[model samples]
Target: MPQQPNCFHAFQQDVSAIKLPARFTFPFYYQPHPLAEIAAEQLQQTLLTNNNWQHNFGLNADDDPDSAVGKMFGILVVQDQQGQLGYLSAFSGKVADTNALPGFVPPVFDMLSKDSFFKDDLAIITKVSNEYKQALQQPLYSQLQRQVSEQNQAFDKALAQFKGDASERKAQRKQQRAQAKQTLSEQDYLAFEQQLSQASVIDKLKLRDLKVLWQQRIQATQQSLDSVEAEIQSLAKTRRKLSNRLQKRLFSQYRFLNNLGERKDLNDIFAETPFKVPPAGAGECAAPKLLQYAFEQALAPICMAEFWWGRSPKSEIRRHKHYYPSCYSKCQPILGHMLEGLALDENPLLINPGKDKHLAIVYEDNDMVVVNKPSGLLSVPGKNIDDSVYSRIKRQYPQATGPLIVHRLDMSTSGLMVLALTSRANKALQRQFVERSVNKNYIAEVTGIVEADEGEITLPLTLDIDDRPRQKVCFDTGKPAHTIYKVMQRTATTTRLSMYPKTGRTHQLRVHCAHPQGLNMAIVGDEHYGTKADRLRLHAEYLQIKHPITQKVLSFKVAAEF
Candidate 1:
C-alpha cells in the first residue's frame, strides 16, 4: 500500500523471549492505527490542529519476532477521533516471505520499526498495503467455500436416498401386484384378505410380496438418517477443531463452558461463589438442579422461537413483527430490558448465577417462560453489581435466544412474570395480558386497623420518591391503578391483607394500604412503600393464564404469609 505523507506507525511492543500457546507480546493485535501524531512533526501538527487522519499498520511476529526482516511491511498511518493514531485494528495483512508458515503467524512480535515508507516511496508501500488488506478476507472466503461444500454433500446425500427409496417402492408395487394376481391361492388369498381387514391401518401392511420394497425403503430411510447424524457429528467436530486450529495456526484464544458441572480454574478464582448445590439427600439429582433443568428445557424451544421467528419492535420481518422490546431512555436499565426481551446471544453455557440468584419461576411451556421474582433482583444486568433474569437465562441456553421480557416486576415488588419463548406465543401471551385475561394475586401485611371487612383501594400510583409512601397513591395525574384488599387476618398492630391489584401500577397496594384517610396504614415491612420490617413482606401468591399449547386455564397458586 502507498504510504501517506508524514504519517508513520508501528506496533509498540517488545518481548525478550517467547513461549507457545499462552501469552503474546503487546497483547498482540493485528489491526491498523493512525500513527500521524507519533509520526514526523509535520504530520503531528496536521493531526492535532487540523484534525486530519492517516491510516497505518503495526507489524508483529509475522514480520520478524525481533527485527523488520520477515514483517508484512508497509502501512497507511492516520489519526483517529481520540486524537490518537487510528484505523481498523486486526485487519489482515501479508508479507512476501517465501518461507511463510502454512498456519497463521500471530502478530505477537511488537515494538514496531516503521520504515517511514511514505517518505521513502509512498506509492510503493500503498500498493502493497492495499493488496495485503484485500488478502485479509481469505478466511471468510474459505469459510464460505467450506459451507457450500458441506451443503452440496448434504443435498447429494438426500437426493441419493430419495432415488433409492423411490426405486424400491416401484419394485415393491410391481411384485405385490404380480403376486396378488398369480401367486396366492384362493384359500391363501382369503386368509390374507382377512388379515388385511384386521390390520389397523392399510399403510402398515407388511406382505411377503412387498418385502423388497418395505425392507429397502426402511434401509434407505435409516441410511439417510445415519448420514444426517454423521454429518451433524462431523460439524460439531469441525467446530471443536476450529479453536485448536486457530490456536496452532494463529495463536488465538477464547473461552469455553465448564463442561463437567464446574470449572476448577474459575472456582479457584471465585471460591466464594456457590457451585451447583445438591440437596442433602438428593445427591446429584437435587431439586434445584432438576427444577432448573426442566425449566430450561421447557424454555429452550420457546426461547429460541422468539429470537429466530419472533418479531422485534423494529424488525421488518413479518414473523418478528410483534417483538417489541419495551425499552427506551425513559426506562432505567433499558439495555438490561432489551437484553431480556429482544436479543441476547447466550454462549459459554450461561454463567449460572451464584448466591444472589433471586428468581421465582412462575410458569413454563413449550412456547413461553415465566418467573415470580422478589424486588431486589434485577430483570437484567444493571449498575448495582447485579444482572437481570434475561442475562442468566441466556447464559444457560445460548441458542434459541430472544429477550422477550413480556412483562416486568419492580426490583422490590414480588410478583408473577411471564415471557413468551416463541414469536407466536410472545404475541398471544402479550395479548392475553393486555386483554386482562391473566390473573395475578399478592399477599401483603399492612399496618394499623381496618374497620371495613373488605373494600377496594382505588388509587393511581407511580414513583413518588417522596419520603412518605415512596410508591405513593395520588389522586392527581398518576397512572390509573386499583387494588382490592380483604382482611385475611389482623393483629392489634397489623392487618394481614390479601391484595388484588385490579390495575397494575408502580406501587398500588402499599399506597392504598397507607392512604392518609384510612388508618394511615402502612404495609408491614415495606421500606420503600411504607415503614414496617427489615424488608417488604409481600409475596406473589397465585397466577392464572391459558396454557400456551393446550389452551386450557393454568393457575399457579402460592399461599401467602407475613
Candidate 2:
C-alpha cells in the first residue's frame, strides 16, 4: 500500500488507460468522471475490507436506535506537484465520533481538537445548561409554583360562591317588597325600601373587600414563584448566548482557500445569500473537505464525486453506493468561491434541453389541444429559459386566452399533455384536477424489481428547506401524498411500473418510488433521487378528462420512446 503526502492515496492499479477529464467537475451538478469513479471503487473496497475503525452504519439492523448513521463520502482526483495522479477521500462532517481518519483528508478546521477554543466554550455552555436543569428541579421553586396555582384556584371558587349568595339575598328582598306593597300603608312601604337599599350597599362593600384580600394573597404567592423562575431563565439565556458566540467563532475559524489561494471564512461566503448567517454545518460537506485539502497541498484538481455509504435516513432518500451531487444550500456558495480559478464544466441546467426536440400536436379541437411533450422539456417556462410547452403552445395558439396549461409533468418526463384553448375550458380542467376527477397514468422503469403487484403509497412530503426544489418525506410538516402503482413487467435488474398518482404534488411519483417506505426503487435516470442517465424514464402516458363545453369524456395516450 503506497501513500502520498498529506493523506493522498495513490492508485494501486494502473490508470494509464483512463483519460483525464477536460475540466473540473461543477460540484452542484455533474456526472462522475472515469477517474473519479475508479477512485470511489477503490475507497469502497477499503471500507469493506479494512479493520482500522468500527462504526455501525445501521445496515444490519435498521430498528436499532443505538446504531450510528451512514454518511456521504467524496473523492477528488488530483495531480501532485511532481505530476503524479492520486485521489483524496473525505467523509461529510465526522466519522466514528472524530474528524480524523488515517486514509482520508483532514477537515479544513477541526473544532474537536483538545486545544481548540470551541471545546472550552462548549464546556461552559454545557455547564450552564446543567445548572438550568437543576434550577427547574429545585424544591423551593416547585413549592412556590404550587402555592400560586392553589391560591388562584381558591380565589376563583370563593368569589363565585359569594356572588351566588348575594344574588339569592337580593331576589328574596324583591319578593318581600312586592308583597308589602299590597298588605302595608305607603309609609311602611317607604321604610321597607330604605332598609332594602341599605342591605344592597352593604353587600357591594363586602364584595369589594373580598376581591382586595384575594388579590393581595395571590400577588404574594406569585412574587415568590417569579423569583425562583428568574434564576432558571437567566441560566437559559447564558447558555444560548454562549452557544451562539462559540458557533460564530467556530465559523470564523473555517478559512477556505480557493485554487488561487484566496481565503474566505464561512460568514463571508454566506453573507450575501438569503441565509446571511451560515447554516449550522456549512463547510462540513465532503466536497468542501476534499477541495480545501487539494488547494492546501497545491495539487491541481481534475474531477470529483460523492456517494452515500449505508442505510437511508428516515426523512430523506439515500441509497447505499449511490452517487449524489453536492447539496445546494451548504456547498453551493462555498464552492462558488473555492473553485473560482479552475476551468469548470458548463452547467447543464442553463442549457435549453428541449431546443432541438420537436413538440408534436397529437390532437386539437375548438376548446382544447393535446400534445406529445418530449423528454427534457419543461411543462412551463423556467426561470432561466423561455422555451417550454407553454411557450411553444403560445406560438401555436396565438389567440388562446387565460391559463393554458391544465396540469404539468416534470421537465424530464416525456408524454401526453392537455392544454385548454379557451378560458372556460381552463377553469373547468383546473377544477377537475383540484377535485381529483381527472385521472393520469405514468409509466416508469425503476432500478430494482418490485415484489408487490399493486399497492398504494401514502408518504407525506415537504420541501427540504436546505436543498431547494428537493422534496423529502417529512411526517411532521408535510402534506399527504398518495400514489397507487402496479407492476407491469419485471426484468432481472429493473421493473416497469404503472403509477397512478392520487394527489398531484411536486415530484410525488418520483419520491414515492425512490423512498424506502414506498417502492424502495429509484426510477431509472432520475438524477434528483437516483442515478443520472441520458434521460429520466418517466412519462405521463395516459390522461382522462371530461370536455368542458360538451360534457363528453376524452382520453389521450402516447407511447414512451424508450
Candidate 3:
C-alpha cells in the first residue's frame, strides 16, 4: 500500500486559533458536537424529502410505522487538506450496500468481502460446527442413549421387585408372632416374637444383596453414558477453539494509526485491559473508523458525534432523532489509545462542573440534618469527585462521627436527603430505611404522556456489569424494585408524575420508567435511558420519617423546580 498524504498540516495551522474542548468526551456521556448537530438536521431533512430514503440507506421498514425504534448514526467533523470543514457519517451496524454510500465512511475491515480472510475462516468454522451437530445425531450416539435409558428402567424395576419381596416376608414374620401369642403365656409370646425378628433379619440381608447387584448394573450403564457425553463435549470444545482463534486473528489485522505517527493494531489497543485484545469489529464503530481514516489520510479531527437515527430497540431505551454518547464497552478502549499525540481536547467529564454549588440545608437538628441536594452533585465522594453531600456535611460538622449518609440519590437527580449527625441517628435512620418506614416522593416529567392516572410498577433490576452504572431489567438475578406513580399533569408530549419508590436500587426509577414491561416511557432528559436535556427532570418532592432523637414524625417537602 502507498503511503497516504499528511492532512495534519492544515489542521495544525488553525490549531493556534482554535479553542480546544476542555476534554475528549468520555464516549459514554456527552452532548453532541455543533457540527454533528448540523449534520443530523441535514440528514433528517433529507429523509423527509426522499420517500425512498430508507431503501437508499438499506434500512428495513419497521413493522409498525408508528414505532420510533430504528437505527443509530454517527458523524465526525474533519478538516481536509484545503482546510475546509466537512463531516463523515456512519451507521451503527451497517448501512445500504455494506456501508458503500457516498457521504458515509466505510468500515475499518470489510468482513463482508468475499475475498477477505474472514470469509475463508468462517467457512472452516461452519464446517466444524456442522460436523459436530451431525455427530450428535449419528445412529451410534442415539443407540447408546437408548441403551442407557433402558438399563436405568430395568434397574428400577428390579429394585421394586426386591422391595415387594421384603414387605411380604415381614408380613409373614408378623403373622407367625401373632399366632404364637394366642396360645402361649405372655413371657413365652415375647420370646417367640424375638425369634421371629431374628429370622426376618436373614431375609432382609438377602434383599440387600439384591439391591447392591442392581445398583452396580445401573452404575455400569451410567459410566457408558458419561463416556459418550464426554466425547460430544470434546467435539464442541474443538469447534469453539477454532472459532476463537479465527476471531483473534481477525482483530490482530485491524491496525489503527494515531497522530504521533505510531500504529497499533486492535490486538495491542486492548492488551492491558481485562480483554487482552479488542472484540470482533472493535475498531469498526463510526468514531474509530473516522478517526483512523483521518489519521491515515492526514485529516485533522475537529469534533465528532454519534446519534440514534431511528426507533429504539425493544430491549433497550432509545429515542428517535436523539443524540447518544458512544458505547463504553466497545469504543472506550479503542478511543483511549487512538486519541494519542493530537492536540486533542481535555475530557470535560473529568472536571466537576458542580463543585461550586453548595448543599442547601432544608432542616437541621443536633441528631440529624436534611439537605436539599442539587442535581449533578454526588451523594457521596466518588473516585474522581470529592465534592459531595456527605463530604460537605462532614466539613460542616467536624466533631460528628459514624457513617453520615443514610441514603443516596442519583447524581443527576436533585432531591431532599437526610444525613445523620451521630452514630445513633445513622443506625435509627438506616433501620427505618430497611424496615420500609421512610416515605419518599419524587417529581419527574417523562417523555411521553401517561394514559393512566395512577399505577404501581414492580420490576426486578440488576446492574449491566459490562456497562457500568447502567441497570437492566433482569428477572432471574435481579433485586425487586417497586414504584407507585400518579400523574400530576399531562402536556402535549410529556407527563409530569409524582413517584413513590418502595425499594431503592441503583437507577431503579430510571429503569422502571423506561422498561417496556413497566411504564414504557423514559424520564425526560434521562441521558442514560432517554434523550439529553438541560438536566434530568427528576426531583425529590417530599420526605416523611420519624425524628431519630425525638421519635416525632417529621415531614418535609421541596417542590420540583423543573
Candidate 4:
C-alpha cells in the first residue's frame, strides 16, 4: 500500500502513561478511548488556527447564514508499518466545497475533481434544463398556448347561447299547438305541427355545424402547440436518463475497504437493508473515510471517535466539542463490513444492566400502588428482553386483573411509577394522562452551567426516518412538544435542573435539554444525546394525580439516588 503525503498526525503530548485500547471502536456506540481523545483535542486546535481554507461554521458573529454549517470531525488512532503511533483525521462530507484539504484523509472517491466524469455529466444536465426553460419562452409557443385556451372558452359560450335560444322556441311552439287544437279543425292542427317539426330540424343542423367549426379551429391551434412541446419533452427525457446514469456511476466508484482487504461499493452494502438503495451521502461519513485511509496505508486500526464542532444545526441537537456516536442509518451497514474481523469493543446495549436490581414498593391499595423504579430497568418488555416493571409486578401479584402499568418511563430513567390494580382504576388513571391533568416533575444534572433560572422550550419533534428510536427537531412533520425547566443548583461544570414536561413524547426531556434552541446542554450521563456516564443523571421525582375510587388528589415523591 502507498502512503499519502502530510495526512498522518503523530501525537504532540507525551502519551507514555496512557494504555491503548484492547479493541477497536464500535462506531455506533462507546466512549472515546484516552488516546483518541488526545488526538481529537489536537485536531480541534488545528481547526482554530489553520487559515489555508475558509468555511463559515457560524461560530463567528459576522458569518453568512446561507453558507454556514457545523461539521462532524473524527480521529482514528493507528499504527504505521514501522510500528510508529499516530492518527488520521477526516471531516464528514465536503469541507470548503472540496475534499482535498491538507492534514486530512482524502475521500473514497472525489467527484469534484477536474477530470471526474460527474462534473461533465452534471454540466450536460444543466444545459438541457436551461434549454427547456428557454423553449417555453418562445413567442410562437406562447401565442399558440393562449390560442388554445381562448378557442375552448369561445366554443363553450356559443354552444350555451344556442341551446338557450332553442329551449325558448320549443316552449313557444307548445303553447301555440294547445291554442290551435282548441280553435281550429284537426287537419289544420296537423299542418301547424308539421311546421314546428321543420324548425326543430333546422336548429339541430345549425348546432352540428357550430361544433364542427369550433373543432377545426381548436385543432389548428393545438398542432402548433404540439410542435413546440416536442422539443421540450425530448430535453426533459434526456435529463432524467442522464441524471440516473450519473448517480449510478457515482455510487459504483465509491468503493470501501475492510481490514482483510475486502471491498464493497455503496449499492452492494445497502442492498440487504430495509432501504434498498443507498441514501444520498452514504459512503462519505468521517468514520468510513478515516478507516479507509488507515487500511490503504496498512495502518493498524486501534480506536476512533467523532465530535461536533461550531454552531449546531437547526434540526439535530449538536453541541460544540461534544463526542457523538456514529449515525445508524448511513454508516451502520458500511461499518458492519469495514470492521470485519477486528475484535471491536463489545456493544454495551446488548447486556442487561438491571439483572440484579430490585423493585421497591412505596405504597399499596386495592385500587392502585406506587413504586420506585430503578435506573437501567425497562418500564415495559422490549423485543429482546422480557424482564421489566410490568413483568416483575405481574409475577408478584398473580391476582391482578388489569394491566399492571398505567404510564411509563424510559428504560434509562429511574423514578416513581404508579400502577393500577383493577380495570376501573386503569381507565380512570389513563384518562387523567390523556387530558394533561396529571402533574409530574423530573430532576436531572446537565453537562454545563445554565445562566437563566427558569424558562420554557416549545420545539416540535419527529423521528429521523432512517435512524429509528432517535428523535430530531423537525418543524415540518413533527408533533408539538413543550417543556418547562428551572435551575436548582449550578456548579462550574454542571447544572442541576427540575423539568416539567407538558407533553409525553419519547425523549422529550432529554432532547429539550440537549437541543441548542432549548437549554444547549445534555443530561450528564445521557448516552443518546450526551456522553456516556455511570448513569443517565435523570430521575422522575414527583407525581400527583386524582385517586380512582377516592376521587382525592394523591401526591408521591421519591428522592434521586445520584
Using TM-score as the measure, the top candidate is 2
TM-score of each: 0.35, 0.86, 0.79, 0.79
Give residue 136's lDDT in candidate 4 (0 to 100). 79
Every model's Cα RMSD, please? 24.2, 3.9, 5.4, 5.6
| Tens-digit lDDT string for candidate 4 (304-350) | 99999888888887778989888888999999999997999988766
On residues 67-179, what C-alpha lDDT tens digit does candidate 3 reach at each position?
A: 43366777666766765765566676565446445556667777777778988888988988888888798787788788778877887787788779878878888787778
Model 2 scores worst on lDDT over the 10 consecutive residues at: 59-68
Model 1 TM-score, all chains together = 0.35
lDDT by residue for model 2 over 1-562, one digit each (tens)?
2346768888989998898888999887888898999999999999988788877777665546456588999999999877799999999988888899898988889888888998888888888999999999989998998888998899999999999999999999999899999998999999989999999999999999999999999999888888888888999888889888988899999999998889999989889898698988889899999999888878899999999998888878888898988999898999999999999999888999999999999889889999999998999999899999999999989999988999888899999999999999999988999999998899999999899999999999999877778899999999999999999999999999999999999999999999988888889999888988889999999999999789899899988877
Error of 3 at 11 (Å): 17
Rank ordering of all candidates by lDDT, starting from the highest: 2, 4, 3, 1
Q: Which stretches of candidate 4 lie over 4 Å from their true place?
A: 1-5, 61-66, 127-242, 363-369, 397-406, 419-428, 466-468, 491-493, 547-553
Q: What lDDT is reached at residue 312 by model 3?
A: 55
**Which residues of candidate 1, in runs, are more than 4 Å off?**
1-362, 465-469, 517-519
lDDT of each: 0.43, 0.91, 0.78, 0.89
Best by lDDT: 2
* lDDT agreement of model 1 with the native: 0.43
Kindly report which residue stretches of model 2 are placed more than 4 angstroms away from their true locations once superposed.
1-4, 58-68, 139-213, 357-373, 389-408, 415-438, 542-562
